[model samples]
Every structure is written in C-alpha cells, then in structure tokens.
Target: MRNQVLLIIVLLSALLGAPVATTAAEGISISETVLKMPLADDVSMDDAVDSMKLRANTLNFKLVAHLPLYKELEAMDIETNRIEIFQFCDARIANEMVIFNPDFSAYLPCRITLLEDADGKPWLVTLDLGKIIPSANLSPELLEKAKMVRDKIESIMQAGANGEL
Candidate 1:
C-alpha cells in the first residue's frame, strides 16, 4: 500500500513536471519569507507580500510548487499571517519533542501552507511534522514540538476566522 502511494506521488510529479527541487520566485523560500514578516496578531496581505519582496534575497528555503492546492488555500482566509516556521533540522537536533526519524537526517519532512481569507490577504503557515508519517527515523521529542506548532496555528486560525480581534 505504501509503495503504491509512493508510486502515485512520483507518477503525478512526472505527469505534472514537478521537480524535486524548484527555484521559482512566486512560491519558494517560504521559511525565509515567513521569518521576515513582523510578528503581529493581525497582518494584511499587502504587508505579507511586501515582506516577501523585501526579504527575497535572504531566503535559502526550497519547495516544489503545488499549484491548484496552493491556490485553494487562499480561499480559506485573506488576512494571512505566518503563525510560525519549524525547522525540523534544528528541532530534532535539540531533541525538543516526540518524533520518528529513520535516517537521522537531523530533521523531518516539512509542509508549508498558506492561510488566507476572502480579502486575498495571506499568512504563510509552516510545520515540521518530524517524520511522523511512517518510515521516518526521527526522535520522538521533535514530534511533540511539531504538534505544538500545528495546534498553535489551529488556535490562531479559530480566533481569526471568527473575526475575534
């Protein structure tokens, strides 16, 4: 079953011409971009884009651009603010939470999502799940931290989504 899913992902990537590594300005280097934005309870879309433009030079982060789904996240909310960025590398190294790492690569796979409302504002949301998804060789410690980050976003979104300023 696992092999089947892996095959499907690979096949889809091939069909879509998705590269394992990408360097596009529109949606790469998200971690670095999130880091640049100011930490505010409320942030605007223009602010997020301006921050991305300003700090584009300092980002070394990389990710394959998944278009349709990525665009869909925008419909979720407009006033998106980066809740947080978890570097699975550093988190694992510090043994901060419960996780599972197999190769001990010092980190786990990362997933980045964007929060946005109808207004078109965006918040870059990042999470390092710490190899929780089977075959992962990571310390359990990091997993907890990853969950914490995820939960934090959930809480923030709940409040923001409800217009609870």
Candidate 2:
C-alpha cells in the first residue's frame, strides 16, 4: 500500500514537472528544510533574543514559550554550548490551519532556536516554512495566511540577526 501511494505521487509529480521531495534512498536536504542566520559579532545573544521578542510582539505573534535548554543541560553537568528555543503563535491562523488539515497541528506554534557554534558565534535557526507550506495543498486563502506566517517568521529572524527592535 505504501509503495502504491509512492508510485502515485511519483506519477503525479512527473506529470506536473515538479521534483519529488525525496527518493527511496535519499534523505531530506538540510538546506531545503532549515533557515539559519548568523548574528553579527557586535550583537550579543541577549540583544538578538530581545529583538526577536519585540518583533514578534509588533507582528502580533504571541511569545508562547521559551526553553533555556543549555541551562538544563548545565544543571545535569553536561558541558555544551548555549542553546535555547522560543515558540510563537498566531492562534487564529493556527486554528484555521488545524481545521483545514489535522496534520498541521503537529507544526503548531512555530519555533526558533538560538545556539552558539563551537567557535562561540551565535546563530538563529528555524524551519524553512517557504519550502514546507507549498506542499501542504492549502486553499488560496489559507495559503496566503501561511505565507504571512512564513514572512513574519523571516522578519523576526532578520530582526534578531540585525539586533533591531
């Protein structure tokens, strides 16, 4: 049954001239699935996080939760670089998305992660919604909303990277 579904998808993609997301032997490309931005040398992690929070608020996205993962690991005596996650949501759009497709619930409340590389350079990362949303087969109206969400996320990332409030 799974093979049948896969065949059908391949046929459809061929007819449409769209590239299949993956093959039986291939994994998803990291470049296609993630968006990452590096912080400027002068911008501290605190400033970037503050800028992101301020941008989210300005865009009316609720800062739902924050997880200071590094602190927890530190408590466990695990030596690791700084890592934190911030979750944001627009409830109205999120609800509409779930109503349209239950699977979307799995992606609810978008997330951004902040981490420091081995060299101690800060970076912000998030899912590349631009690549995911087009495959969801959303209605035109919902598609616009989804794109808005993606844009807002990119905006927030930019603000954080630039340390712009």
Candidate 3:
C-alpha cells in the first residue's frame, strides 16, 4: 500500500512539473517584432515598459485565478509590451490615445507602460485608468469593447498553451 501511494505521488508530481505552454494573446502570432519609439533623452522608457509588463503579469494571474477556463493560466509562460500608433488602431473603442504617465504622485489620468522589442517598437500598455483619471468617465462602450478584446486575448493564450496555436 505504501509503495502504491508513493507511485501515485511520483506520477502526480511529474505531471504537475510539466511546463504549461502559452502563446501570445489575441491569436496574434507575436514573433519577436522589433519596434522602436522615440524616447525623451532623459526618460527611461524601457524601465517604464518593464513596470507595466509586471503589472500585466499580475493582472493576468489574478484573472486566471478568478476564471474557470484559465486555471492553467497561472502557470503560463507569457510576455507583453507596449505599442503606440500615430493614428488610433481602433477609434470606435477609444478616441484618446493612451500614453505613459511617468509621474503618478498626485493624480494620474492614465498609467502607461512603453514596451520595446528587439527591433525597437514600443507598445503602450495601460492599467488603473479609472483611478488615475477620476474626473473623466471611461465610456461604458469602450469598457465593454475592452473586455471583449481581453477575452479574445485570453482565449488565444489558452490555445497556445494547449499547442493548438
């Protein structure tokens, strides 16, 4: 009986130890795209982007923990960065362009992270938007659109983890 129990433990550990694979969010085949953005001479854009990435990871972990379809997401190997466009990509969703707010001491309208890839394109990711900008109402329409986008991204990530991507 002891030997059977030991065998079961070993099997469980082996399965649990296996790496959970994940692909980029949004079914977006994010092969190391190198995008570079012009940075203010004195600012640390890279560091700011890194900070946002950390927050994104935390957000993803929390979401996974809360959602049933993404329990395995806690173990996912994922990455993200910030991207900016001169013209908005999805204007229907958000009219205002999202940018990095380096300082957040008093009141922040938006929290921005500029992520740079090997090639140097900076992707701008954001969070804490509502708190940062307490005065302005983030449109309900935009929020719902954002939720849809997030769901699609999560789906893609799960598919990637399952080697379906």
Q: After superposition, how far is residue 47 of candidate 2 from its true place, in Å?
A: 0.1
Worst 10 residues of 2 by lDDT: 10-19
On TM-score, the leading prediction is 2
Q: How accurate is candidate 3 locally (lDDT)?
A: 0.31
lDDT for each candidate structure: 0.36, 0.81, 0.31
Instruction: Give the lDDT of residue 34 in candidate 2.
Output: 64
Candidates sorted by TM-score, best first: 2, 1, 3
Which rank order by lDDT, best down to worst?
Answer: 2, 1, 3
Instruction: Give candidate 3 regions above 4 Å deviation.
Output: 1-137
lDDT of model 3 at residue 55? 42
Please give, for residues 1-165, the per-residue lDDT of candidate 3 as tens digits.
Answer: 543343334332222222233255522111211111234344354353333334435444222211111223334643323332111123223333232222221221222223344454333332323222333344665455455434433332323222231
lDDT of 2 by residue, 43-113 (tens): 89999999999999999999999989889989999997888889999999999999998878767788888
Per-residue alpha-carbon lDDT of candidate 1 for residues 1-165, written as tens digits (9 for 90 to 100): 543444334333322233444357433322322211122446554344334333321232222233334334457854332322222122433333332323333223333333442343444443323223334433465545555544443343333233333
Instruction: Give the distance in Å from residue 159's predicted Cα in candidate 3 to where it truly belongs.
Output: 1.1
- Candidate 1 vs 3: which has more TM-score: 1
Instruction: Compute each candidate's TM-score over C-alphas.
Output: 0.27, 0.84, 0.23
Candidate 2 vs. true structure, TM-score: 0.84
Cα shift from native, residue 85, model 1 (Å): 15
